[model samples]
Target: MSSPAPPSGAAPTPSLLRPWPQFLDLSALSLPISLSEATYRLTQNLRYFLPNYVVITLLIFLVTLVSRPLSLILFLCIFAAWIYLVFLRDEPLTILDYDIDQKIILGLLAVMTLVALLWTKVWLKLLISLIIGAVIVLIHGILRAPEDSMEDSPYGSLLNVVDSPGGEHASV
Candidate 1:
């Protein structure tokens, strides 16, 4: 037997359990536009603020080169930058700046992770994590750059591209 048709001008009944529309919306979390925007903004900042990257890298290297207090200070600096970008930035969450400063902090964690692998030194893991994070950022930067663009940026080298609106190098 076939089900009865709905009455004229009456809405159709929705499933008592899960509804199709709700399910589709929930499953759309992996949308590409959001991911690509995130990639663009992230690489933009990383390519722009490479000194911050170097500073963090050197700091981690120093941690390996020196003692504990210096490492903590360097890590704190990295963390402070992250708070600024993630909390204070006006851009939409999906398209916020790439902010490699935070990655530097994570890289330190990676370093610590690396050390942990060789030994039980928890601090060393920071360095290991830092290295891995750097590799990821580098890959993202390369992928984000346009193929036919000559001279990535006028301000700095190919790796760093801080371009001003008037066609000049703004700053590093």
Candidate 2:
């Protein structure tokens, strides 16, 4: 049999599972008048209040300082700077438009190239490793077939590095 309703002027018991009935209301939000406003507020806060570029640079610097040797700190710092510049800062003059995946691959290739150049005892091996890194980078670009593929020159940059007698200025 069904139970009787609550007595007059008496409040009904609240459910434990569905506590905080006001949580369902959309108008109860205090911050962010709208979606665009929220985004603008966050961006503005970061731009004015937070010094992200300096923080990343300082972290990298500290990591490099406390470490025993400067083997990978330089690479780490460059990678961190790349991340901050690519994702956070909106300065078009100092920004790079490369995709995140492409940037990661390029960063790895850069680290490998640097290591190969430094750790190698002979010049020929370093050259070979640099060429291999370049080939891998190019292959990634071809496989992905990105919108910026045309910007990357196949025979120009790759060939210049592969054919250069000495380890020239190869910015991968």
Candidate 3:
């Protein structure tokens, strides 16, 4: 039976994800016909949906690390320490009234990384897990339908993440 159409004032369909609908548009997923087509789709989709891709990769990385509590904890600690100390900190780090140099912090990070590798099998697992994440992201980027203009892409109109040409995203 033919159903009646909705009123003109009706709202549009809700997104699969409220913040980003295009992130999981199963209807639009497809395989590229050729290498050049795949490359074009990948480049365009990566620029158009980079934030979604990053979130997916991070979720996969964290989920994989969950099976290894020690590795997860150690990795998080090292990452958090580096972020807070090097990027977010407004004041110099000090120990025993001695100002710590950035070089020293980097050295400590390298030593800690070596210890993490030597004392555990984290190196292999970490490499495999992250590579899996990146592969998944790359696959998504290549499979999603290509957008000729990133600014006119679905999410592009909803969010200003991708600025118009000659704007903040100058490269785009």
Ten contiguous residues minimizing lDDT sum, candidate 2? 14-23
Clashing pairs in 2: none
Candidate 3 Cα misplacement greater than 4 A, ranges: 1-20, 79-119, 149-172
Which ten residues in a row are the worst by lDDT in model 3? 11-20
The residue pairs found clashing in candidate 3 are none
Tell me the lDDT of candidate 2: 0.42
Q: Clashes in each model (backbone N, CA, C under 3 Å)? A: 24, 0, 0
> What's the best-to-worst order under TM-score?
3, 1, 2
* Candidate 1 vs. true structure, TM-score: 0.25
Each candidate structure's TM-score, on Cα atoms with residue i matched to residue i, is 0.25, 0.22, 0.50
Top-TM-score candidate index: 3
Can you write out model 1's per-residue Cα lDDT over 1-172, one digit (the tens) per residue? 3446768987433212233343224333332234554465456546444544454454555455345555455556544554444434443333265534545655665675454334534355556758955875555444443322234333234333333334545598
RMSD of 3: 15.4
Question: lDDT order of candidates, best first?
Answer: 3, 1, 2
Could you tell which candidate, 1 or 3, scores higher by lDDT? 3
**Model 1 misplacement above 4 A:** 1-33, 67-172
